[model samples]
Target: MPLLDPARWRLLHGGEAAAVEPATGEALGTFTLAAPSDVEEAALTAARAQRAWATAPYSERAAVLRRAGDLIRRHEPEIGEWIVRESGSIRGKADFEIRTASEECYEAAALAHRPLGQVLPSTAPRLSYTSRIPAGVVGVITPFNAPLVLAARSVAPALALGNAVVLKPDPRTAVCGGHALAAVFAEAGLPEGLLRVLPGGAETGRALVEDPRVRVVSFTGSTRAGRAVGELAARHLKRAHLELGGNSAFVVLEDADLDAAMSTAAWASFFHQGQVCMTAGRHLVHSSRYDEYVERLAAKADSLTVGDPYREQVHLGPVIDRGHLDRIDELVRGSAAAGVRIAAGGRYRDLFYRPTVLADAGPGSVGASPAYGREVFGPVAPVRAFDTLDEAVALAGDSGYGLALGIVTRDTARALDLADRVPAGLVHINDQTVNDEPIAPFGGLGDSGTGSRFGGEANLDAFTETRWTTVRATPAAYPF
Candidate 1:
């Protein structure tokens, strides 16, 4: 049986919005367009089940997460297919998402065995300590670009830490992101009602945030939307962990290996059709090597193939949908109008947009180009030249976003210096910006987010609350 057999799920009746293959526009399946009432029901359900889950033995919680990881590996073929078709990811990228999601489960499993609290020194014949407790129900809102991994990163840790999750997956990727996870956890022996999959839009998300039962809201999406979610969560006094938008920079120094820099730059900007939040939106190359770098990068972009992942061997797949494709085109057109040279591609066939490179987008001209100035969530690389180290740092740090930054240089000292000067959360010395590991603290600063900082020990803080307790062997003398 298919993993997302809608009949086996608790789907609401008479809901609109069907999941479709973005490249082909074929109807894959329809998920319940969760209404506000549904969000209330899910939040209530999660709250009711959370007490027992929080009290469950550490071994039991760890076993559930380990089994979920195993089950995901066992069902890789089906899950990968769902991601490729539903989310418009290339075959290899689907595999990457599958692996990352599986790793997330494994990482979260470790959270159960870690030290939960600290023993503090006491002045008298008493003991003082701090214990961690679940934050109760957590609401997770994931976007369509990389649904499975994004959801898993938060969901797995939230569950392992003993908080129930109410997941609000993007309707465009509901099947792979929502139903697939629910099915895995169920088969892995997770208790019923601990995980609620609500696939929906802004209304559903707002409802989830507003639900009093949800103590925390973990959101991953555009910066604009993230701000709105953050505001709502704050008004309701809920902790919001936002992993938002980014216009990351890829810096290439004069002393860097040209071949390696060019290859890595292409991968950084064009990976997953550059729909990633950490996609290298700006290319900062030293003026001495700028011309050569743009030429090689544009050639590489031109050579990449774009099509339906299921049908061909393509490096890039279509954008999520037509609206996204049109937005990308508008940015590229505006960049061209602002005198940014379209060195390679600035076109598309249906939703399959060609990997594009915009050259000569310097500081003076970039202000007028939306592609360079904002987070254009598409496969458009805007290259700018910098003459000095200070200029490069200035260019990189000037953006309101500080998600990820990459510096390619043979001089380790220079690379380290640049990394220090930049305010991004993740920095790579000799590599590109689009990267993630379950063990690393993943987040950003400024408009990017309010520091989601999800992964490893950070998950403990994000999902649980700490309380101080003091004990005495005998009753202490009371002073009324």
Candidate 2:
């Protein structure tokens, strides 16, 4: 069977664009792009659907979401394979994404019937209460990396909250991610026009954000693109939930076990080719273990298998595209020239970049070179040595992006202290930097995001609005 059948779904507008398999540069299929007018139409349709969906019975909404989850699980193998072809994810990672996305649908389904109102005391002869209401039309813009999961992160919650959604997925992976999601919901008995999937680039996203009918915008992508979305949403007085980029810091303390740290570090830095936003960009090691840690990490990188994503033993796969591959290569070259020594794999064969580890990439090198300072968004780990716990904390807090931080230590007191001091939104102790759960508050700090989080109870706030109401037994006296 073909990886994707474009005719199985609907398209809004625009010309056709090819969906290329990153692993082999094969043209999976040509898909129709969503134009600006299509975005406008989707917003209008969402507004209409939202009016009815918002008043739907909680049971009805919950049932639909539950069905969607079941469908996703039942078709995980096919969807996972499509994800590998569309987004260049290896088998394990692709399956993980599909499973996570399916779980998100179930988690979100529970929220449908959950309590959404609060009763408050009133000073006068009146009863006061606040109820959560849908934020009208929700515009979701998701990135290619982990597209299915990210879309589910926003779409499921918004739908569960009774808000109709207009999803604009990255053009590169729209078939397996966005269009697939739309089809799943439709099959699950969701009303027509309630969820619209439009695959396109910046123009479609801009149109969705600027559309007056779209009351809320949920975006997950690069910090640069997120900033533009925020600005556009702000100008239109629309609510925006931004999950942007990250340059997470992985700290290895002296008390940490070398073998454990090395294993976690390898996965955190190289998984999904480090295309994940929460991938650890910097490894801050205690001077006591820096040398041995780097040596072990280098060996681990050399052992990883990089080839066909479908192969059971393949550990890594190609990046999203050639442009990104070129960018990763440039960063490695520039960093190498800045006196940063490559301790492990540093070369690229086609779209597959070998997992790379850089030594002596301390504050000086990071600040002096873009490759070290900015989010590399590739399978590269820059290890820096720090003498004191305070220095490690300082180094981790140096970046403008603060999505997540990892601390590997046996001392609970020291770990807690450092976690408190770190500016990141999510802090992990004895774990890798790349982590997420359906019920946790997922977002970042500073340029990493706009202080808005999605997941768990946070999704209720992001996808809904609170309205206060009061009931009076008698007419209130007014001042003359």
14-65 per-residue lDDT for model 1 (tens digits)? 2777789988999986666788888888888899999999999999999999
Error of 1 at 427 (Å): 0.2
Task: Find the 10 residues in a row with the least total lDDT in model 1.
Answer: 7-16
**What is the C-alpha lDDT profile of model 2 across 119-219, one tens digit per residue?**
99988788999999999999999999998999999999899999999999999999777988887898889999899999998888888899899999999
The CA-based lDDT of model 1 is what? Answer: 0.91
lDDT of each: 0.91, 0.89
Q: What TM-score does candidate 2 reach?
A: 0.98
Q: Return the TM-score for candidate 1, rounded to 2 decimals.
A: 0.98
